[model samples]
Target chain A: MKGTFRASMAWLHTGLGLVTGWVLFAIALSGSLSVFREGISVWMRPELPTVPVQTVDATAHAVAWLTDHAAKSSAWYLAVPNHRAPYVFGTWERPDGSYIQKALNPLTGSPDGIRDTLGGEFFYRFHFELQLPYPYGRLIAAIAALALVVGLISGLIIHRRIFADFFTFRPNKGQRSWLDAHNLLGVLAFPFHLMISFTGAVTLVTMLLPWGPQAVYKQDVMAGYTDLDPALESRAASGKPGHLTAITPLLQNAEERFRGAGISQVYIYNPSDAASLVTVIAGNNGTVSTLSHSLTFDGTTGRLIREHVETRPAVRTYTFLYGLHIARFTPDVTRWLYFISGLMLTAVIGSGMRLWTVKRLRLPHHLGHVLTDRLNVGVLGGTSLAFASYFLANRLLPPMSPHRAGHEVQCVFIVWGLALVFALIRPARRAWPEMLAACALACFAIAAVSSPWTNPVTQSTALVSLLFSGAFGYAAFRALNGKAKQT
Target chain B: MESAGTLRRPLATAGKSLSLKRWDLACRILAALPGGYALAAFSGICLAVWLPGLRVERAMTGMLTGLLIWPVAFMASFAVPDGRKMLGGTVIALLALMGLAALRGWRP
Candidate 1:
């Protein structure tokens, strides 16, 4: 009976992992990249200066720019410049219901010469949204996260010699090597994998199971949100036009009130009206909770209106989990640790899927075996190549091209689709090494095309790309040699 | 004649048991997936309605804690060898939770 139970758990682990492994891989990989989302945004736009700027100066620049260009906008949102992101990120809602987003210069407050692109925001969105519309993508991603949770639990149960196997790695043994690698990666970063999956699922829990809120709020979702993170009472815009007060003092007041937590976001409502209000949000620099104290001020007079801080324990707990997953509060060193662990998690998923195929290849070549093997190469290899192409697209596309951001995103999907087709047409043995080689070439190209070696951010980004290039090149060589041995 | 009859009985029972096992597995899957989710949702509803706190806080706590039920329910569904018992137990627990929620003024 005990043996049967273990066998059943093994079955569950394998089946669940196989079903959700690809989507989880994509999510994990993109999530890993998103750890450096701000840096990647900076890298994508080489036109932006990397010199650090003061928060007040950046906010002033953004406010001035919005007042000049987006005066008619209902509201303007500004993300102040920080250590990671060097420029002010601003977005405003126009009267026509359109939204414009730009990275404003800290010195000049202009978007001059900056190309239009989603930058790192693309990967961040794709991490959770999966490029699908509205709730569908989020729903799918959430379900995949839940599946990952189940997979991890079952995998733990099935890995009987977990500690014993951690120190064992027999290389060049084909299937056994793949299993060992998968187990090693999974076991090495087990806590990170578990935390990430559980937190990832919890982040979207409301969407997955809305019954709790539904039962309590009964169609009043906004009320529940108000309770979770209370905001100042919103007022309608008075039609009378008024001149806006300077924002620098108001931000200083908020910073003082927050006790030097620094200001992260500023929201200006009814910018040209008498009822204009400015809301300054505290940055998540020092706290594990994303819930921060916010201060609202009268936009016309720059007088304090109200201060809001989350005090509810339950709400604080929820935000802490959410913030842990977002990792915005981490310092530079901790952020790198997050990034490395994220990559390790991705590697675990990839190797686990590869183990499934490698184990089956020794058996008679059934259709299922053939298809899984081909897809394993296509998805795992193709995504890496596609990610490399995204960077390549950013560098190669015309700076002034219309709809350039959309085109860059399209480049990713188009290359990924072509890689899939290439994998399908070619034999599995050839496809593996060929795709890895292409990935290496693309990474090398990205490093080669980067300019201005003086900037530390750009230099480090290029160095990372070169490192990836070397890794992929070595993998491609190994794959080619392994195929030669089989023949 | 008795020996021939015993042999025939074992053959028929073997054929019947194979189909029965397949049905059991199918039922177990159903219980694990959709039924497990239903159990989790109902548990969330119960917590939201019955827990003592501000309405929103109760709801948030319930939602957060309720999501954890899914994996446990999923594993539990397979841990039991009898599929019928597993499905029946899930249904009973879900109904009881819903009943408790109803008593606490929850609707829909």
Candidate 2:
């Protein structure tokens, strides 16, 4: 009976190990790759010459420009450039107050052709959003994360000599290499693994517990928000046009109020009206999740309203934790650590799946092994192909072209599908090298093509990217040059 | 004293009826969910201060809530050895918390 129970656990382990392995690997790998989302964004956009830190006059500039350019705006937001960001971005309500975001040249405060880049935000959104319409993709990713968490926990319980095998990675022992790599990576960065799961769950807590705030507050979320950040009630003036002045004095006043910490944004509400307010959020650069401090003033008389004169306790705690999740709050050293850790997390999951498939090769006809092997190729190889395609799509597709994003995504899916097909149709022995070569070819081709695009990143950076792309191509060719080597 | 010890072993080790060590592990896992619910719910409560928008305030509150999920699980496991019923308890607690929040007018 005891033996039977153990056998059942083993069967359960094998079943899950085989079933969800590739999906887990893909998620981890993509997540790790996305750690450099910002860097990649920098590579994509063209260089913008730095402007003088003219934020003292930012609110004034916005008001002046909008008054001349966007008179009769109903809804508006003012975004001032900071040390980290290269441009000021904003949108205004046109008589009706709907939002329309645009990039402003801080020097002249005018819209330019290049103001369209969302940069790292694309990958950040893609990492979880998966581009599927609404809750479906998000729900799938969340369920995958839960599966990953359960697998990791069960793995720890099942592992016999966690420490003894911590550093022991034996090669050429069928599943040994993959298993060792998985165990080593997983154990070393176990904290990161665990945190990612829980925080990921935290990120999805709303979805997980949708009923809480829904039931209790009767959906008066705005009222609830008031409880969180206390706001002053500004009396609405008589339903008449109130004469207004420029926002220069108020801008300087807010800057003076912030003193050392620079002002990152200026929000002018009810502009040209008596009840108009200007909120200047002070800047602290290079942090995750952009919420900051500053002063909110009456844009009319420039009287001080709610001033974040000091670091409020609740706000500080909130920013710090968000920083941890986004890896933005840390210095370069810590950010690099997070990136590396994220990468290792991907490798661990990838190898874990491969190891399981290899171990299961003894099963009848070994169809499962064949499926897992193909899956491994499809996921890892397909990932490289997808990324390469994105780079290619970005380069080939017109920058101003409205369908650019959609085309790029299509390229990724198409390349990934091709890789999967190639994996399935070809012999497992030949598939690895074939797929590697294919990925390399795509990467190099894309890198070569990208040079023609007038992107912002420095030429030196692009050339280096090209060189690395070529290097990968060369390695793939060299590996496949010989007879196909089966694991 | 010996009889009491033996009685505890039957329930703790072999577990109830046909349940065994795997069941214990399952219990641990099951117990964890409710605790996680509480922890997350607490974080949700903190976030109500800045509802809808996942602003800095909400993010900070979320971190606090995220940490609670584990401890709640740990506590539930230690206090109630039964695997399934505590899950029921957790659901109740979560539902109640949500209902209370909704009753208070939390919304989109």
Candidate 3:
């Protein structure tokens, strides 16, 4: 019974790991890194240098400048600076209604005109929502997160060694290396695995929660969100027109009210109306979640109606957990930590796939290991090919090509498709070697070919970018040409 | 020349050669920097509690709540050690921490 049980457990883990592993890892890794997307974007652009004595006047000035220049905005979000964040970003709804983000200069408090920066938001979107169409993509991502929880729990139950494995990495040990890597990955943030599982699952609880709303609340799901947050009803307009009072006063009042809460953004709604609401959202640096501790003031009368800080006990706990998951007001180092774990999670998925193929090939059975080998090469090789090609296409395509984004996406899929094709014709062992080398060279060459054509950066920056591409290409090429022959 | 017989032996010995401790190590290496971040995430939250301005108390029930994760994560590392190994590693790590702390004070 014991032997059978262990065998079953192993099989189940392997199966589960193989099935949803890639998606789960991708989600985890991307979400992890995105924790610091804002910070990373600033560092990457390096447009904003630190300055002291930045004023609410300067911030208001910037907002005014943006509002004047904004030919496309209906609503504007002005991101106020925190202790760690250097610059503020104003997000506005474009003509198409998509959120367009612009960085605000800390010095002049004006729009800095830095463009093409989706920032860490892209990764975040990819991680959780995966660019899938709204409800479906979100649902699938949530399910994958649930699978991760399962994988994490089952892994703990099955692992016999609780300590002996801490600092063990024996290199050139074939399958042993993989096993070591897997264990090491699992162990590193075992705590994170546990927290992320619950938090990630909770992050999507609206979808996962027992169809209580569908069964009970029916059409009143909006009521659930509103009930959970009673603050929404505050400052609701009574249909009278009046220009807004000075924003500076509201900002000051909010700062005083929240005290340590660290006011980050002042959201003004129903402006020039008697019922306008001015909400001061707390900065995320010191906070754990995105649940804003807001104090809403009426527009004309200037009276405080609701404060998130003054919520009931049950609602407060609910908000706290939600905040923890959203990681609204986390610090710089913490966000980086999120990013690092995210990268590791990606590696976990990739490695798990590699292991699946490796084991399948090693065990030559009635079914030839051909499919497994091909799958390994296709997924691993194809991912590299697709990413490299996308970068290449990004540079090579016409600057004004209406189809540039589509074309870049096409190139990615085309290379990915070629990988599957290559696997089919050749022996999996031979296919891996040749395709990897091709992918490497293609990656290296594409960067070189496109550097002069459409790159927007300076010569040095473009060269550095090419060099970066070359490094990865070289690594891939070297790996494919290694002494470790396909068995 | 004597390999045909030996080739089969490996498959047979696969089960016997399996090391839970080794497997544990492999997972950790894979976990990498993110693993550290995961801990940092919680600790980051906990640090919020330490702030004087935020009304969090030492009496929160969940203070010990997260301690449970340390064992789970550690055990997941497959770090089951004898009394001596665990004690020795802990002592060494603590000594290192102290030295670093002392250096931090001195430098400042």
On DockQ, the leading prediction is 1
Which TM-score values does chain B get in all models? 0.76, 0.48, 0.29
Show the lowest summed lDDT stretch of 10 residues, model 2 chain A.
Answer: A225-234
Estimate every model's Cα lDDT from 0 to 1.
0.84, 0.58, 0.55
Clashing pairs in 1: none
Task: Score chain A of each prediction against the true chain A by TM-score and list the results.
Answer: 0.96, 0.76, 0.77
Q: Which stretches of candidate 3 lie over 4 Å from their true place?
A: A43-59, A66-74, A94-99, A106-112, A213-218, A234-242, A272-274, A300-302, A310-321, A325-330, A365-478, A481-486, B1-108
Candidate 3 local distance difference test against the native: 0.55
| Clash count per candidate | 0, 33, 37
Task: Give one digit per residue, the lDDT tens place, for model 3 in A85-146.
Answer: 55666776766768666667776666543433444445566667876888777878866765
- Model 1: residues with Cα > 4 Å off, grouped in runs: A484-487, B1-20
Worst 10 residues of 1 chain A by lDDT: A225-234
Give the per-residue lDDT of model 1 (tens digit) for B3-55.
Answer: 32223211111001122377778877888999889988888888888889898
Per-residue lDDT of candidate 3, residues B20-107 (tens digit) = 4554444443332234223322432332233233222211112222223333443333233232344344445435533543443311
Top candidate by TM-score: 1
Candidate 2, which CAPRI tier? incorrect
lDDT of 3 at B32: 21
